[model samples]
Target: MKAKSESLTAKQTIFYLLLSILLNSSGNGLTVSLNMGSALWTASSVNLSHLLNFDLKPLLVIYGVIVVITNTLLLGRIEPRRIINNFLFMVPFGYLVGWTSQLFNLLPLNQLSTPLKMLLDCFGILMVSAACSIYQRVNILLHPNDDFMQIIRFKFFHGNSTVAMWVSFVPPIIVSIICIIISRQIYAINVGTAFSLLFQGSLIGLADKIIFPSLKHHGVEQAVN
Candidate 1:
């Protein structure tokens, strides 16, 4: 009886881990695909000369590689139950929010009106929350030196989890703000550009916030049950 029970538990654990790995891989695939598609569409929007001048492929490849490495590290330390189930829920949700943002202008809103902008903000929160959740599920591995920032927060500040997260995000947030301003001024970023930016932001948020924590909680709940 003990041997059989142990065997069953082992099977269940493996199943959960595999499911998490699959979910992260597929979810990232979907996200990277969508972002690349959006960027390519942007590339198509301008003149050929301008398009040639703008080099995004290198950036794309870097982010892609980072995603893989981060996933590998995080997955190595954690079970799938900590990441998969939440991703299963939030990946689609983030995609939906992105789609909605990308289409809000087309849905009879007058050029980023107050109401439409408010709606975008609301959805943006939803997207960020979703991403943060996803990240929380993942352990250890992180993209683009963010883990280093987290460590700094932990070591120097003796910060709480929330503070650590906010501290880690500040640099990226500042960079993003600068990029958005430049995109608007230099690139003449239109409604679509704006939407894509928000979409991408929310995509990350969904992974980091919404799905990650949800998965962790689900795993804990399952263990308790």
Candidate 2:
């Protein structure tokens, strides 16, 4: 039973936006480098990269572009500001994930014990969950996949984060299935994928209450528009 969400000021929006992007990229990078698994959308991109023998970074960018199109369809309107905001989020996020992954790859994650790796993976997911809570509240510029979830959360599911998260996963699940059909293999779908599917939304909702209880969703209309 949280109180009503108040709007974010411009400076607060920018602060959360930057902080969330950093945390999100770092979390994604850890999962990528650890190779335990990733969130389904990221896993789908990895699967598609393997299937097409394409570079993962560019493939990720392309994947974001596709999600942008899907979101546009869902919104049923073409808002250039919203479109540009998503792209702005895409580029830096892609670069940061790549850079962080490469940095972490220099470590000896492979030699780590299984339980330790699992702990690390869970930590990464937590970082992502926290980031989602922050940025989704700020609602300035967001990763397209996050934007998808936000739209579903507010528009269709009546601000039910968990339902929206699960529903938002439909596209990636389809993409992964298509890749498996074509390649007879899977990529990046494993323990982390299961963890995310089960708890990411719940964790995000929890974070809103515990992490920054004062922060609330801002500019929600932009999500539908």
TM-score of each: 0.36, 0.93
Off by over 4 Å in 1: 1-112, 140-159, 173-225
Which candidate should be chosen as best, given lDDT against the real structure? 2
lDDT for every model?
0.36, 0.86
Question: What tens-digit string does per-residue lDDT give for candidate 1 at 1-225?
Answer: 001111224554454444443343333323222322222122222222133354333332333344334533633554355245434433443344334434443444344565554444434333333433343334222323333333433444442344545444444344444654555422323343344334543344345444423233222222211
Instruction: Let me know the TM-score candidate 1 reaches against the reference structure.
Output: 0.36
The Cα error of candidate 1 at residue 26, in Å, is 15
The clash numbers for all candidates, in the given order, read 21, 0
